[model samples]
Target: MLKSFDNKALEELNDSNASENERAKKGLKKRSDFGYAVLFLGPSLLLLGVFVFYPMIKTLYMSLFLTNNFGQTTIFVGLKNYTSLLTSASFLASLSSTFIYVIGVMVLTIVLGLALAVFANQKLKGIQFFRTIFSSTMGVSVSVAAIFFLFVFNPTTGLLNQMAGLLHLPQLNWMTDPNLAMITVIVSTVWMNLGFTFLVLFGALQAVPRSLYDAADIEGASKSYQLFKITIPMISPSLFFVGIVTLIGAFKSFGLIDLMTAGGPNNATNLLVYRIYQDAFLNGNYSQASTESIVLTIIIAVMTIIQFKVLEKRVNY
Candidate 1:
């Protein structure tokens, strides 16, 4: 028995040594592969640094200095632009409008998208056709969508006005009304983005395992119960992705506001991006624009990080 125990111990020691040697071999191979992986990734990294990171740094640097008379003169004025933006009432108003727009669009888009995705997920006749019809708007350009909305909401000759007239309802001056102008922008943004979000959610819904639903049914769980208990948790990751994308898009919105409202009616729909454009080109305040841009970037980055940190904890996987 002693000799048998000694032999067993020797066998265990030999197995342990073999496992360690195998792990060391794998580690060496991984290190060797990492060099090739870096070599392949180098070009894309270089391009990203040149186009994205370098310009980002340059924008921050330019924010610290002022350029005068079409870049003919330069002066270093640190933090003045930021201070002025924070104190200016118009900037503050535009900032508030931007926040409203982001929140409005984010909520409406997600709600509407989820509804449409669930509807499309049903096993109905020509469901594929319906899905395609809903998602077709994603192919339209932002400027094109803005133009379409502009004509549709025209006070006098727009389709919406015509419909209202036919119904004997009052016509709305969507663009001229300061109160409605931002709402109009939000509606247009939601319309333009709803299809993409719907597709994302629908894909996630389809990816859920059938066995889970089968088990839920066998347990006498109602469809609604299963959906809330299983479907939502299963698709939480996709919802997180959609939420982040929609929020970022909402923050960066410029083309729609530019084409539709042009920040008119006392700058009712002037978002941060439009303000940046106005500062850089219309006002010729490059330093201020750069400062605003940097601030906007930081806000977006912080919000995105918070979103991931919070939502990641909720995702089942």
Candidate 2:
């Protein structure tokens, strides 16, 4: 009876394997069938081709030409526009301003977000309330935030100046002053980005194991020591992710600059993205704009690569 049962079980296992092999063979035969894939992916591919690839290719092509106000290409310049932009004082200034804005925003957002997340992660009463408050700005639209800051940063008749007057402090121009304009915009951007960064870091903090902290405590580690040795290492992945995102967002910022400064006060806050916009629309220099666009894209790509190369090794996971 035992022998018969063993043989029967082996036969059943063989039958199951045979059925699976047949099904796999059928699946292999059907692999060439792309009807469903085309049905699903055709629309997305078409959209990408029309909207993304075509524009990108056109921009590259246009960058090699001299375009008129009527969007007509007059001559093939073959990187002359790029050379001119590279040698131009205004373009260089815009590039410098872009770096300042991107770096400042990235640093401030990551530091403040991590600080707030650590604070919120502590066990205390009303912690949830503070977390909600810190994350509230995530819901604010970019236009609305820019408008709100416009009022706040107004040199005269603004809340900041009014408060300064109450304390008899000297009123400083926020938007009009070349020295202060870029700083003002950077601060506003940092604030606008804070909510999302804070939320991400906050979640990352929660996911860190309490056992690690307990172990550190048992080892008589100081809070600061634990923070540097353990907490930061654990959350470094989140920090890196947020840093990359903030870097890109800073590079692409346009709305706040448009609303508040409009690259005013001698082009003090004229970042690369806004410069591109101005060249294309306001000045009707499409070729130059496209050249700057390409440059901007390359700059962003390089920065992203550098960040990944340098920062990825530090991330714990």
Candidate 3:
């Protein structure tokens, strides 16, 4: 009996030691993996901290104080900039125009992009050429697009005005006129961003299995029915993604607006992003600009959250 107890105790002790050794090995492996992860991610984290996070923090910090022409904060003004801007007519107009521009860009870009993607997806001859042309705008930089649109929208030599003259129609201003400036900007911005949206939707359409369409066809479903019921649901996730991306892009639009309109013709095209630039550089209101930047960031964040909450429910995946 004593010998049996001794054997049982020895076996239990050995089993305990084995389990401990296994745990020790697992612990060492976890540490080693963590070390490797830190090594791999350190550079990216450092870069983000220095370039993105630090600037964001600095901008928020600067928004709380009054800054001189050099953007050097001097007085500790708590929320005065925010209150003043929130009540300013210029700020209100810019905010309204910003929403209009963003919504216009977001809606038109998605619709036109999807239309182009569908056209390019057809298996007709010379389809590859059309696809290339459809996606070619993706390679065009903002500076190039803006410069090209400048001459295109000019009142005299502009293609639209020339066409109007040829047709003996009324001559109309494209960029200089306040009524048409925002529309022209929206059109150009849509054209510039369409290629990216087209590419994403096209890729998504390609990934959708043809079997679904085949099944629908065998059931005597019409083409439009198939498109709405079959194609859209399959690509809903991509559509959701493109919507958010284009929304954000529209909100942050600056270079093209700066080059084209300069928020001209009685502040009609004065988007919030351009307003921020005008405040800081043109008007030399750095502290208020910083506050505007913070407000813009918050608006974007809230909009993004709303999109995710609302649109994500319809996403197939």
Q: Per-model C-alpha lDDT, please?
A: 0.84, 0.86, 0.86
TM-score of 1: 0.83
For candidate 3, the per-residue lDDT at 268 reads 89
lDDT at 91, model 1: 87
TM-score of each: 0.83, 0.87, 0.86
**Distance from true location, Cα of 205 in model 1, Å:** 0.9
lDDT of 2 by residue, 180-273 (tens): 9998899899999989999989998999999999998999999999888878888887787788879888998999899889988799999999
Candidate 1: segments with Cα more than 4 A from true spot: 1-42, 71-73, 210-227, 307-317
Tens-digit lDDT track of model 1 for 192-214:
99889988899988998888988
Q: Cα miss at 235, model 2 (Å)?
A: 1.0
In model 2, which regions exceed 4 Å deviation?
1-30, 304-314
Judged by whole-model lDDT over C-alpha atoms, candidate 3 comes out at: 0.86
lDDT of 3 at 212: 88
Residue 207: error of model 1 in Å? Answer: 2.2
lDDT of 3 at 287: 96
